[model samples]
Target: MENANVLIVFVSAILLFCIAFSRLITKAGIPVLVFFIFAGMIMGSEGAGGIYFDNASAASSIGNFALCYIIFAGGMATSWKSAREVLLPGALLSTAGVMITAILVGVAAHFLLGLTLMQGLLLGSVVSCTDAASVFSILRSNNMNLKAPLAPLLELESSSNDPAAYMLTITIISLMKSDGGGFFGYALMFVMQLAVGAGLGFAFGFAGALLINRIRLNSDGLYPVVAATIASFVFAAVQLMRGNGLLGVYIAAMVMGNVKLVHKTSLVRFFDGFSWLMQILVFVTLGLLVFPSQLRAVWLPALVMSAALMFLIRPAAVFITLSGFKYPLKAKLFVSWVGLRGASSIVFATYALTEGIQNADTIFNMVFFISLTSVIIQGSMLTPVASMLGQLDKEDKTLVSRSFTDYEEDIQGTLYELRVVRGSKAVGMAVSDMKFPESVRIMLIKRGESTIAPTGKTLIKEGDTLMVTTGKTEALLALKERLALV
Candidate 1:
């Protein structure tokens, strides 16, 4: 009981500090994720906080758990219509691009860092995929609006590309444990992992959407809880079935997000906040897992590797994989610059340490250093880079803008006024008789400039302006029908 209380207080304080300081960090043109990570390092065992956390296995577990929420929330927020525009490009980036980046980086590591081919490949794989949490948080928090389909392309690639990186890391680890396999064998494994992961992801995603929309729980609050539990189950079941759990959960959330569920507004809001919490937890826990003293030995190699990844390798992958597409040179360059390695890379590095691979400590430290470098360099410069490449959107100055802004959390439905004219069935009807959609609320009635707080018994006469607080589609459709419009 005592320990639990202490844990609660410690975690609460950390969360509060991070949340409170985020505003200040964002104002300074820095990504708040950097602050969260730095806060963890400062509070770590070697730092002032003296909180010791060196369990690789435990950190990995927490990371995977956090990823479930992070990925799902990302999917839930994705606009499918926009995703369709960049589907082909996003697919290539997430798959072929990952392979190219991994292989090239692997070669560089082998030649420059003096590691074996397989070990170098393993190191490459650890940091191959851009971490979605860091990317999304930075882009959104900064209110960045990229031109055309670039935003969705980046989001879709980041959210879906982790499986490729994970597969490569694990495959290389398997190769290291045994004699390396033939080309055909390795290729087959890659195809199977992707095929299985994607197949199960879509299947589970569709099923979750159907289930959420059909099932009606007694309480609205329970809907978010139910959705969250189902998402976690999707991940676990996929893993058990030898598929990619992260991919499955993300796809599932995307599916659920598109469908009209019972309490969708609440669900999105819940997951949005929940995802941020998980990000803080994952990054901080990763920070605690590392000892700052060890980073000194690998900083040089880390710097070279980070530069190779940010410049040569990532750009090559983006350009080569996207050559067939019609995107402008600027758009492609912007995509290359957005390749920020983050929590997932660090999390995967722990796999090396836990598996007892050769130079696991060195691999972990290098990955940690490189990920930080990516965040500090690429993350900090995303807006300016996009601006320099002429890819930043000029119309919207807001930190973030969603296509479906009405459905966004913290944004209330618009207060719209609808007038009931002649030739309307609602010409002499009571507000209660109109039977508005459950989501629509009639807030006031304006008859001859006499503003009235409408009650169910209030009559809605012709020329009356009904002030409503509801979604546009629901309110407009309901008003059209109620007013007997042709």
Candidate 2:
């Protein structure tokens, strides 16, 4: 118990410091993830704190759990409307693009680094997918508001591609351990994972949406708790059934996100913060698992592989996969540039080590170095690169965008603050009776200290503060007149 207390205190201190340090790093055009990784390195065994950790399995376990929340949050935040436009191209990027990148990298690794074809392919598969945590964190934290379609495309690809990457990683590992079944077996396995995963995800997501809307929790805080727990259960169940749990959780969350649930805003807010906490924990844990000294042996190879991935392989994959699509040249280029290797790559690298592969340590160190360089170089320059491609949205002066609401770009409306006055048409009337103009809605009503979501049946009291959104200035003026706004 005494040792446990000390352990808790030490962890708590690290969390507090790292969370605060994130703010400091953001101003320097650096990715906060890079800082978190370095922080863990400083506190690691080889560094000042000297805490020894070489557990690949434990790190992988924590990473899987962290991934569930991060992917779920990304899914929940995705607006179906925006995703609809880029669905085909995005799906192509996530699936075929990952495969292409992995194959190219695998071939390069096999020839250049003297690794076995299987081992090289395994390395490729692990690092193929763009990381949701890295993309979400860097883009949202830095306010890199990429223009429409591009943002959703990238988001969808990042959140959805992990399952493909995971499939390839596990499949290659299986092949390495046996007298391999041919391409037919591998193809069948991929189909099975995706099909079963999607089916289960849809079923659970529908059930979750129904439960969230119907179940009246004792406290509002419990809403997010219940939703998240159910989502985790979906992941566990799907994995137990030999399906891709990561993919299942993401699709499930996407389903839940598109539906209206009780405490929707608060639940979204809670998950947003919760996901950030998990990312920090996962990255730091991964950092602790690495020994900087081991990195020295693989640095040169790692640098060469990283260069191939960032320049040759990634670009070729993106351009080829998106060839027949309607996206502009600049969008394709931007997509290729933003392919930042992150937590998933590092986490997947541990699979090789856990399997006791001969080259596991070398693979792990190379992956770690590659992820670090990717985030430090590509992640830091996302905004500038997007700007060069003319794909970035102008900074919005009105809404103070939080990560949760960063993707709320579709609601193109002018927000108006209005106060209800005595004897106005709106006062002492139900919100439904107010007959708000078309494209105008009362999003929130603040009556003194309490805030209401402004249901149709809710009465509008005098002196209440109303936050209304309207599509046109005329509609706002009409609302002002009816409400007798001061």
Candidate 3:
């Protein structure tokens, strides 16, 4: 009981400190996640706090649990309408681009770090994907608005590319354990994981949406609980079937996000906050798992590898994979620069340590350094780089803000007040009966200074001033037509 209490207090302190410190450093242009990691390191056994924690299996379990929700939240937040425009490019970037980057990094690691081919490949695979959390944090935090399609492309690629890197890592581990045999068998396994994960994801997503919309739970809060349960089941079932659970969870989320469900606003908000908690936990846990002294031995090699990844391998992969597309050179260059490896890479590295692979310690340390460097350097420079490349959108609108289902709130679109004229068609009609477009929302209504919190059943009245908000000009125009104000 004493130990448990101490544990709780320690964790709460770290969380509170990280939260407060992150806000203070936002203007410094450093990624807030870097502080979460530093807090863990500062509290580790080697640092001032003297809390000893060195269990790889525990870290791996916690990291996987956190990553599952992080991926799910990302999927739920994605807008299908926006994603559709860049699907093909995103697909190629996530798959072929990952493969190219991994292979190049693997070759470089073999030559530069004196590791065997398979071991080098394993190292490469661990850092292959651009982290969704890191990319989303940087883009959203900077209030970045890239030209059309580029922002969506980057989001889709980061969110969906994890499976490829994961499969490659697992496959390489299997080969190393089996003395580099069974190449064909592992390739077949890789393909099967993706196919099964994708199929089951779509099936579960639609079913979950239908259940949420029809169940009509007694409490609004229960709706988010149900959605979380469905996500858990989807991930567990896919993993049990030998499919990639991360891919399954993400696909399921994307499906549910696009479909209509009850209490969607609350659902999105719940997962958004929950995902942040998970990220903090994952980064801090990873930070606690490492020893700063051990990193010294691998620092030079890790630095070399980080440089190669940031400058050469990532750009090559982006350009090679995106060559056929009609994107501007500046856009492609910006995309390549925004390839920030973060929590996901560090989490993936824990897999190697748990599996007891050769040089696991070295691999883990190198990956940690690489991820830290990427986030600090690339993450901080995203805004300036985009501006230099001429990719920043001058318009106030941002792709990150509009990427969610509840985008009107994020966009903070124009608000209009129009008094209901006597005998207007909208008069005496319920707000629900107005049939406002999904993009438009009635904020409130005022009649004779008696403010009304408008509900679906709230009736419009003569001389009532309606406060309306919407992000879409077309939706606003349509609402005007419906109210006979145009």
Query: What TM-score goes with each of the models?
Result: 0.82, 0.83, 0.85
Per-residue lDDT of model 1, residues 1-486, tens digit only = 997788668767876887888877765546677777877887899977788988999998999899888888888877676688888999889889988988998899999999888888999899889988777777766767678777778888998898789888887887787765566786687777667767887887777767777887787788788888888898899888777777778777877776665567778878889988898888889988889999999999999999999989999999999999989999999999989999889989999988999999999999999998898888778888888999876754322345322243332587777778788888778878988876677766777846665555567777888777776675567567766743
TM-score of 2: 0.83
Give one digit per residue, the lDDT tens place, for model 2 in 128-149.
9998777776776665656666
Model 1 residue 26 CA deviation in Å: 1.9
Ranking of candidates on TM-score, top first: 3, 2, 1
**What is the TM-score (0 to 1) of candidate 1?**
0.82
Q: Point out where model 2 deviates above 4 Å.
A: 1-10, 395-486
In the predicted model 1, the residue pairs found to clash are: 143-399, 143-400
Worst 10 residues of 3 by lDDT: 402-411
The candidate with the higher lDDT, 2 or 3, is 3
- Alpha-carbon error at 53 in model 3, in Å? 1.0
- The C-alpha stretches of model 3 lying farther than 4 A from their native spots are 1-7, 396-399, 403-486
- Residue 415 lDDT in model 3? 81
All predictions: root-mean-square deviation over Cα?
8.5, 8.1, 8.0
